[model samples]
Target: MELQTITIKREDYVSIVEINHPPANTLSSQTITELREAFQILKDDIDTHAIIVTGAGRFFVAGADIKEFTEAFGDYDAAFAMAEAGQALCDEIEQMKKPVIAAINGAALGGGLELSMACHLRLAAEDAVLGLPELNLGLIPAFGGTQRLRKLVDMPTALEMILSSKQVKGKEAAEIGLVQAAVKGDELMDTALTLANSLVAGKSMTSVKRALECVVQGADEALEHGLERERVKFAELFLTDDAKEGITAFVEKRKPDFKHQ
Candidate 1:
């Protein structure tokens, strides 16, 4: 589907959603709305098993459109609403059934960093720079960055990054657990696609989705309860035809052909 602020290209079952705002690819209110719509389309696409999100040109996303905040000026309520809406978008991405990977091709600051945190995994180009620099504007990361950042790194590291507004290169970001890995700029998409395909290969979509749910929800629950839930999910997969085929193939030393059943 055509969109005003984003472009979607598909290769097999992986859909690549690129943020198309020129220059820095800043996320304005309208762009956010477009992103919401784009993601909804992907969510409904049965053939799309995984998604890679990136930006065109030299940026992944610099941040939210500063113009919106400047125009709002002192309207605290409007600003708060904007924060809530952006956070909701991040929440939607985090809760998506299919895996969403952030391919950071360049700078990802403030809201951009928050956006990356929302993805199931993040892969960045070697030259990419990431940070939460909203402090320079006398603001903070309002799009779940405060929470998600802590989850990715230690409390001290998260506090340092968010409060200091420090930018780190892609390799350093990966070293600190901000990204899964750093790849050469030219190989970013190829690396992202490879990871996306690996996630869905020879696996039942039902099990994959269930496992994601367990991991996401388990973070908030007690360990014993979470283990019990995982056990239940494991047992449930036994009833799936995909599981049967996988087990049979394993015993026969042959590759399994998963039907996503």
Candidate 2:
């Protein structure tokens, strides 16, 4: 697809998706649609083993386009649709088989933070700022932020951040487990790429796919149910060719050459 709001670049097995919306890189309707399309394509691409998302300019996505909010104002249906759209996109990202990493080079506020939260992993620049500042604009996070924030941080901290419209620097974000790590601005992309590559380095795509499913689909369920799911998947993997090769290679004391079958 011809992307107008984002750019996609391939680096061996990793696809770097950069939001190019100028200034603050706010998420407009077009930007959201384009992102959804881009990810959909990447999801099925065999050449891509992982994905990294970042922003072009100084902002990693400041927020949703405030101007678009005006169009949905006073229309309950319109506003509800908008929220659903954003939530759906985030859910897709969260459930993808291949891991997605957010390289937060600058500010990640409102929808931006929500987007990063959707990723399986996140790396931010030390100077990067992240938060859900919708309350400052007489609004609240509508794109799964209310649910995801509490999962990352405690209820009290999430409540305080949202209610007070607080923004945290990347270091504090890491301390609170909001992001995995924080590095220098110049090292953000390299760190993200390294993390992404490490996830798929010597693994079979079949195993990778099932592991992601086990975690994403099972995390929200009861312990018994999650265990049962994991057990079933573990048994099923034994039937795959990759599993046989991996087991035999262990016996031979050599690296297993995975065909990603």
Candidate 3:
């Protein structure tokens, strides 16, 4: 399928979605809408077990297309649509059945960083920069930042990043848990693939999806729903070859070759 604003490719069970708007990859309302549609297509795709999002040129995504905010010039609908696009992208990525990983190669600021946070895992290039700079524009992140930021890191850290609007290096982002790890700029996608493929090798689609749901529902939900969810998922997986292979492989001291059943 052709996407108007982005490029999409599926390599076996791993799908790579790239932002090719060029320059700084500032996301506009149209681009956001297209990204939502692209992700929707990926969600419906059974062949793809994971989705990795990145960007072309020198940026993952610099931020929202500030032109929209300025052009809004007090038009509430403009503001509404801009925020709607950002929020929709975040929500869609979060609830996506297949795990989504953001491979940040360069700058990811404002909504760009929020986009990264919505992913189940994030891998950034060592030279990449990330921050929430909406404050400088006299605005705040409207794309689940206030909520998801605190969830990813601590409140104090999230607040410090948001309130202070200071950009941080990839290693610091990883150290603070904003991202899972930092690799060389050229090694960003390689690291992401290593992790994604490892998950594909260990679990079926059902178990993977359920695990993501459990975590996204948060720690409070984990305490209340985790065990029950895990029990149900485990029982379901038992009927699949994946479970047998997994158990037999463990007892055999060999690798479990998952079938994603």
Which structure among the candidates has the greatest lDDT? 2
Tens digits of per-residue lDDT for model 2, 111-211: 99999999999999999999999998898999889999999899999999899999999999999989999999999998999999999988898899889
Runs with alpha carbons beyond 4 Å of true place in candidate 1: none
Error of 2 at 242 (Å): 0.8
Per-residue error for 150 in candidate 2, Å, reads: 0.5
TM-score of each model, paired residue for residue? 0.95, 0.98, 0.89
Runs in model 3 deviating more than 4 A are: 218-222, 238-259
Clashes of 2: 0
Please count the clashing residue pairs in each candidate, in the order shown: 0, 0, 0
Residue-level lDDT of model 3, residues 1-261, one tens digit each, is: 457669998777899999988678888877788899998888888888998999998999999898778898879897887787789889999898888999999999998999999898999998899999999989999987888899889999989999999899999998999999999998888888888898765567867887777667645474657777767776877888877888899999998787767
TM-score of 2: 0.98
Name the lDDT value of residue 38 in candidate 1.
87
Q: Candidate 2: which stretches are off by over 4 Å?
A: none
Number of residue pairs clashing in candidate 1, backbone atoms closer than 3 angstroms, sequence gap of 3 or more or interchain: 0
Global lDDT of each model? 0.92, 0.94, 0.86
Q: How close to the true structure is residue 112 of candidate 3, measured as C-alpha lDDT? A: 92
Residue 238 CA error for candidate 3 (Å)?
4.1
Order of candidate numbers by lDDT, starting with the best: 2, 1, 3
